[model samples]
Target: MAREGRQWSDFEIAVSDYLTTLREKAGEPSYRRLAELTGIKFSRLRDIFTKQNGTPTLQEFIDLCLTFGKDPADVIYKIMKDLEAKGISLSNIPAQNDPADEANAALASADNGVDIDAWADRIKAEDSVHEEQP
Candidate 1:
């Protein structure tokens, strides 16, 4: 269990160190360079990776990690452990089996004679339409 009033847990330290290694491997770029490449602003990136209080959205962290050719699971594990250390109950967290689940589900649905590809294409088209609205 984490001590009360600690700024960071062991997992947080590991995550920070992991991110540091990633940044170093990517030619030791500045925060601004990481932001430009990963679509995360410098301040927000600093807040997520360097600061302690604010929690990053899972998608943002996953994307940023992926942009550096790193594994997403490691980052997620670090976050999960941090939450655990804080005594947060995780009984309600949904299952996240694998990244290919969506595609696999689509294929499985098609096996039952459903037009999964058409549905996926429709979703893509609808997303494009929504993207154009702004």
Candidate 2:
């Protein structure tokens, strides 16, 4: 279903590339080490790097940023800049008026034992449903 989009978005491509480059620059011997360092599964990291799946969730992205000693907002800015350079304007992306909304949502999901991946999938499903409507 994710492949229905004609390939990963520019943001995904940029983020995947950024992560791959960061891994190399950090001298991380393998994804296993990265997984150990970030507490994210090796398969998940592999999926993100290989683009075998869709983009990672904001939490996963933040984990990668912190693992690479980069600021999440700064990395997001870089990805946005890269996308703009490629003529991919995502200016229509909505902004959250309440920053705590994300934290509250994550906490609520965790209280139900829902991991980030599952939560992301749920959100994606909801988004797809909304997209199909008028």
**Best candidate (score: TM-score):** 2
How many clashing residue pairs appear in each of the predictions shown?
A: 0, 0
lDDT of every predicted structure (CA atoms): 0.73, 0.81
lDDT per residue (tens digit) for residues 7-107 in model 1: 65455555666777778787888879888888888887776667455555667767778988878997667667666788865566664578699788877
lDDT of 2 by residue, 8-120 (tens): 76677888899888988988557788889888898888888888765777888899999899999999888787777788867676543577988887787777664878878
Candidate 1 lDDT at 60 equals 70
RMSD of each: 13.0, 18.2
Residue pairs with clashing backbones, model 1: none
Ten contiguous residues with the weakest lDDT in model 1: 2-11
